[model samples]
Target: MDETRQRIQLVRLLYVSRAVGPQTTAVTDSILSVAQSANRQRGITGVLCQGQGLYLQVLEGERGVINALYNRITQDRRHQDVQLLLLEEISQRRYADWAMAHVLLADDDPMVQLHHPEFDPYSAPGASVLKMVADLVAKGERIRKTSV
Candidate 1:
């Protein structure tokens, strides 16, 4: 079999959680640093977005790897009311270029301030939240590339 055809199964998982306490920049940076390294080592890639005291993340990788990571995430004390919103196999990864891209939305960001006034990611429909994240990631990439 070709190398690509013999590769392990891939899956994507999306989840949302409420922070247990205030999430500061320093804390978020530290979390991103650790997660990026760990995820890279485990063949995982994903994007993490935060706003309104909530976290919305999309992770893609091998089925077993994602499952184990999700298990650990569920047990982590920093998050509460963790909910798995999406989990399914995929032929390709959406965030394959990012080991763990992190986006922290300011309170004044339009998504949180205007369009979705009273936005609660944890309570929002899973598909909509995923679409939002996909859009945000695309925009971020465009900005990043233009600046390069």
Candidate 2:
């Protein structure tokens, strides 16, 4: 085992039932609405990526808020195959300034490889991308980073 192995993050996740089709503009809009309300309600900061029939969300906030969100998300008709990637409290909020943020994960981006893990959907790139997205959300750079 790597004695120094450590990667810390905050997160919340859910899989989408009504998968957003290839054209995601409309779906992203709908999800932003939900994410905006949720972020305000819980004082959370994070991003929601809709793609390949899934919603990959990463939220950072109080532990209780995030937990309650997970409970609610699992029951939402729009979600399925829900699995948590990371759920630890951080020293500071990651998405502190955003009401909500959305991203369309292009199929070929290095981040897209994260959708399926070593089988658990909880390993490797999925985990890495979760952290990456959280940081991107917190930093308010998601759009600029993807701009052509």
Candidate 3:
């Protein structure tokens, strides 16, 4: 098959980074605003979890687009020590509903304690981090529904 006719593979990428400054509402809001606009245009979906000066994000999209986004994120001045935790080809997106979903975690969030006691993304295994993100997303959805 020709290159154009070949199927493009989808992928899910997870990464962790530390905020260069405080993890304030304005900072995260700006990041989300930009990301949502860009990601929607690029056909990407993902969830961003921020807390305690750390950012744990999972991006899902075509391989090249996802890779390019990751590259840009690593160079973004707002984030430091960006570490890619997982990158794998996938048949479907886990976060298809949101172009960029934001979950602001608190140090004492019960879900965090239930999923991972220490809740340190830097030291946690890739699979564990992914699981935590999934749980958080589910929890967010539940909260949104109840509040609606």
Candidate 4:
């Protein structure tokens, strides 16, 4: 396929990162505001799960767009140690309706205890993290929807 075709290929990318400063509501809201606006225009959809100063996010969109977004995220001062957990072509988006959905997990959240005693995205497998995000999304009240 041509470069253009390759760039437009639909894919899902999951990543984990640590917050540089305090994980405040204002900080998360600011990130969502920018993400929702830009993602809507770029045709990106995803979910962001944050807690304990860590961010676990799944982004789905054109391969090139998502790649570029990830690169930018790695450089953002607000985040550190950004690690790509999963990246693969997908038949369809799991969070198609959301430009960016937010999930705030407390240290005591049950989802964290499902697979492990403590929530540690870096130590967890990519698939497990993805499943956790999926489960969180399934619980409507747990996710703050920001649809495109």
TM, every model: 0.85, 0.65, 0.90, 0.92
CA displacement after TM-score superposition, residue 34 of candidate 2 (Å)? 2.7
Model 3 gets an lDDT of: 0.84
- Flag clash pairs in model 1: none
Largest TM-score belongs to which candidate?
4
lDDT of 1 by residue, 1-148 (tens): 7997778999999999988988887777777788888988898998888757888889999999999999999999988999998888899988888888877666777655676676666677878778877877766731221010
Model 3 regions lying over 4 Å from their true place:
3-5, 141-148
lDDT scores of the candidates, listed in order: 0.80, 0.57, 0.84, 0.89
RMSD of 1: 3.7
Of 2 and 3, the candidate ranking higher by TM-score: 3
Clashing pairs in 2: none
C-alpha RMSD values across all candidates: 3.7, 8.4, 3.3, 2.1
User: Best candidate per lDDT, number?
Assistant: 4
Candidate 4 per-residue C-alpha lDDT over 1-148 given as tens digits, one digit per residue, 9 for 90 to 100 = 7786565589999999999999999999999999999999999999999888899999999988999999999999999999999999998889899999999877777767664576678887899889888987786656799778
Superior candidate under TM-score, 1 versus 4: 4
Candidates, ranked, lDDT: 4, 3, 1, 2
